[model samples]
Target: MNTNDLKIFEAVAAHGSFTKAAEATFTVQSNVTARIKSLEEEFGVELFTRTSRKVALTTAGETLMQYCKKINHLIDEAKYDIKNAGQIIGQLKIGCIETTMALKAPEIINYFAENYPDVDLEFRSAMRSTLISEVLNFKLDAAFVSAPVSQPELDQIHIRDEQLVIVSSAQTAKISEVLNKQPVKIIVFDQGCIFRARLESWLSAKGIIKYKSIVLNSLEGIINFVEAGLGITILPAEVMEHYYAGRKLIAFPLNKELGTMTTVLIYRKDVPPSRALQVFADMHKVQG
Candidate 1:
């Protein structure tokens, strides 16, 4: 019922473990359990279903989570308004896809830190789908994601264009050569990645349907695998250059239609951005 209790609940929901939530909140497991129990009793509904391994939110808990996000966001806004008044000083949580985080985010983060020392910045690197979901759920202030985001509740700003490339080992002379290898091993990020989806589509168009998939979460890992001739992957040209520097890999430019993708900054359209977010977004506009 209280803000403190709700914060604990949110932490537990996010971490999906009572012990982990306690550690994140700087408390003990017993206190976290008591608070959650008290809330459940007060609401006459079970908030979480506990198992031997992890905890999951119940139906009532899911409904409360939506309101909890709004409430927490409002609380943050109120504190920012009172403490900073008209100043552009507050916390800005930004999310970015792995490629953009590697290639584009450093300059913007450096500039924001240098100019706005009073503002706190929290940056997260995630897949395109995860970034979009976090922004929509109020977990992030804004996010840099791949374009073609069709969420009706989100507003977007075109940040920059990235040229996509098919990357393979130095031994591979042509794109077709890599594809012709039996059981074409396609290394990529998880299923939610936009680049992976594009790569799959391109392969399908070439009548490739039975390629072996190797999922690696780390960008560096993917690059390393491609260099070792374990598999091929699609990535941004700038990213490949920055990471590999043409040391042991070959990058072939995709066709114009599939090669070019826009990285966009997206935020909730219904909510007005805080002063800090507004100023940060304007900086990107000026840079773009």
Candidate 2:
């Protein structure tokens, strides 16, 4: 199939709906359908299982998607090499954990944008696990994640260390008082969040195995709930201070073990970084 057809295929696979894919690719739904149909017919395989609501990739489609990612990545590299000629003038996709996005990313992003006016910058906020997975899958060029990442397929550069603390409402005199409160509600993000895991571990160590988990996706939501005395949460000290300024919340330092976490920028080791990605990484490296 031609590169244009594969590009449409990738968009459809990513969006999971031909109409949405068409909108993303600036084409009509009929053109997207025709391109996908042509590819399926050429391969003699049903690429996607169609449904009224949305489409799911078939086995053949999944295999094709992997190759499409590699092809797109290579094409991006070629464009950077030929057109930019070592200048930082390509799209840079970056991912970050929510806390980092809230506290640390703005200054770095602003600096990068000012310095590399030609680079198109895109950012996604996700948990550390999701960020790492996205970078490994080529969905992101790089990500800011909780450090101590041991994945051999990835290379990491230390960005900064975050001191974590147990945060509770101002009415609570001590962290123990908050823990001793009846029902012991813990405000947290969904599963696979590193800070949530650390909070759980600390709770379990204190013989608190039974507690109500109040799951909220946004950092503001969690902090607001905690400030309202609904539950307690663990967050970066800087994050709590930066947002709330310690006015409504009391921060309790954790023990040396769970008290600190490092934020590191990670990227896939196998892919040669584009000039944009390399320059971004170097900026952080110089800062560190």
Candidate 3:
């Protein structure tokens, strides 16, 4: 019925166990059960299907959960807008792809730190698809991703151009040479990586169909594998140039359709823009 009751409901729904929710909220199990009973009585509906070991939200509960998130978000927003009147405050959740994190994320964070020190900033790194999904769901205020994002509910800014290149351990080998001479093993990030998808599409189009692949979750792991003569990978050129230079790795260019990507910052259209996010986006427009 109130914010405290909603918080208890959210915790229980999240953990799916009365005792776990009590532990998370630092309350007793009896208090959690009492609150849920009161809420269910008020609504005259069962919110959860509970068994000894698990809990699942009923249809009514799921509906309440959506409103609960929106209400909680609005409450937080109101608090921030009032407490930091005409100033940037509160925490911002930002996201980036691995390549951007390695290349320019530091400077980006520094820009925010110098400008809005009061705003607590959190940065998360993930593949492009994951970043987009997080932003769309309001989990992230904004994210940096490989561009041409076609989401209807989101607005985006073109951050900069990034050049992707194929690197191999063969110091002077060309793309043609690598394709012709051996069974190329592609080292790439996990399934949701945009660069990996691009590389796969390009190679498939070129009729380089018979190749092996190894999925490395870390950028460093991919680079290490490529440097060790284990496989080849496609990465942002600036990343390799700035961090992994002079490593006997040969960079080969691809056609524009495959090699060039526009980096973009994206956020949801429905959410009211935060001050910190507005400044960060504006900075890229002015300085990028």
Off by over 4 Å in 2: 1-68
lDDT accuracy of residue 18 in candidate 3: 93
Q: Could you tell me every candidate's TM-score relative to the true structure?
A: 0.77, 0.78, 0.82
Q: Which has the higher TM-score value, candidate number 1 or candidate number 2?
A: 2
lDDT score for candidate 2 against the true structure: 0.89
In order, what lDDT does every prediction score? 0.89, 0.89, 0.85
Q: Looking at candidate 3, what is the lDDT of residue 177? A: 65
Superposition error at 225 for model 1 (Å): 0.8
- Tell me the tens digit of each residue's lDDT in model 3 across 127-173: 88899988866789899998788989888888888888988886546
How does candidate 3 fare on TM-score? 0.82
Models sorted by TM-score, best on top: 3, 2, 1
Query: How does model 2 score by TM-score?
Result: 0.78
Candidate 3 error regions (>4 Å):
18-47, 50-53, 58-60, 136-138, 150-153, 285-288
| Candidate scoring better on TM-score of 1 and 3 | 3
